[model samples]
Target: MSSTANISTRTPDQLGASRAKAADNSTGKTPGPHRSKHRRLWWTTLAVGVVAVIVNVPWFNALIVSFKSDGDISRGALALGHPTTDHYANSLGAAGYDFPRFFLNSGMIALGAVALVLLIAVPSTYAAIRLGFGGRFIMNASSALRLLPAIFFAVPYFLLMSNLGLLDTVPGLILANTFLNLPLAIILLGAGFRDVPIELEEAAQVDGASTYRILYSVLLPILAPTLVAVSVLVFIFSWNDYLFALVLSSSNATPITLGAANFVTSTGIRWGDISAATVLSTLPPVLFAVFAQRFLVSGLSAGAVKG
Candidate 1:
């Protein structure tokens, strides 16, 4: 009788709240780790999205303006109300700009630079890392060189090229780009070389494999992805280089980077034409990156994990 009186004294709301609490306890599904992890993931995604937006907004705007006409652009609105290909046409050839020639020149020089960089960097990195042939000093020196401004070597390089009669030539640009790209290539290749195990070479040697043979058969295969990554990177760097091209190249060796400057004249800045050229210039590297991103990601990942 006393228990019945006590239960009757409680309100319906109180009884319902008590029953819900009992149900929750029975399930044993509390929100601590799961909820916090989800919250962190959400914040991380939001941050990445914001950063991407901020970085790409200018490029996106440029892309939109590239498709608009000169008259439309003059109106000062960012809309592509009347899209036209005149800018692209002008960039390609309609306005006396031999962009295709510039493209070919840049491609040749970039490829040449990549070839030269790999030729020297690969063997030197192997010797330094595997043979301990002054690896530390080489790495330190390369890092120091990378830190210095490119302009520091401008005059010296210019005089050297002039003496060699290499100024305003394709070979001149190739050598210049090679010098510019070498240090970073060495650093990157060194990292990749370090990721490779010495035991593989030793094992090959036990089977009477020469050092060259072992490097060719064993190490090169493992380093293939890294090589591709380095090649793509060096290609892009060589392709986009403007300062050296400006100082070294003339009509015979002029790259698209230098070619794009033609759009700027006393008549005024050709915003539409320049933007179109910029878009064209950006395509090769973008395509290379997209195609080789798998190798690049894997190579960098491998280098990051030393063991």
Candidate 2:
């Protein structure tokens, strides 16, 4: 009986020691869940930052080059040596190029195109969504238009503009941009309008509001973010457009796109001036995108949720 009691006591103590050793081992070397997660997150963040720098390096280099002299730039120089705004000042002044006039012209054309797109797209999109007047057909037609090459329109548009005496004017360029961007604007705005709840429109109608009034007050406010997004997109399209501007604009009403083209002539190219002008021309769209990105995210999220 004593021997059996001693075996039981010894077995229990041995088991206790094994368990204590296991606990100590676990505490000493085992990684916590939070630490593993943090490590993974750090690696992901570092990878993304590296990719961002790689992608942005060219733009950064271009900006630096724009401020350097022609001699300094040609020797594979990366940094700004004797940073000078001479390129910018000359480009804007009579000494370099007619960039100031070109900028103004492009701005007007882009603004006009955006206005025209909103004016036409909003009503058409509203009709397509709310009234359902051949909505599917319209959407499909717009999509089909995208398949046709833009060059196909060039000849016809040129002839039509000539006949209308709009060849070489801001109005002519605006019209062309409006035509190019209209389908996209209609599709996006139509999708946005479709996401708007029917009950909200009905509620406004119940208060004895006309269709126009309801659209103006309730629907417009709800669609504000979408509108801003579309406007920014339209502006970018109009600003970057080179084809229409090149073909249609004359010296009297030339935009930055065409003016920039002039930098490379039969003679030697003006690399510094061209680089500076390119940077300046890109600024407005960049600023617009940065400022409107939040609204775009919110609008897209809202549409997704509603859908």
Name the best candidate (by lDDT): 1
How many steric clashes does model 2 contain?
A: 0
The segments of candidate 1 whose C-alpha lies over 4 angstroms from its true place after superposition are 1-47, 132-135, 294-307
**What tens digits encode model 2's per-residue C-alpha lDDT throughout 174-223?**
99999998877777787778778899999889999999998899998988
Best by TM-score: 2
Q: Candidate 2: where is the Cα deviation over 4 Å?
A: 1-36, 78-80, 94-96, 296-307
- The alpha-carbon lDDT assigned to residue 36 of candidate 2 equals 54
* Model 1 RMSD, rounded to 1 decimal: 14.0
Query: Model-by-model lDDT, in order?
Result: 0.80, 0.78
TM-score for candidate 2, please give it: 0.82
Worst 10 residues of 1 by lDDT: 1-10
lDDT of 1 by residue, 251-281 (tens): 8899998887754653688888888888888
Global lDDT for candidate 2?
0.78
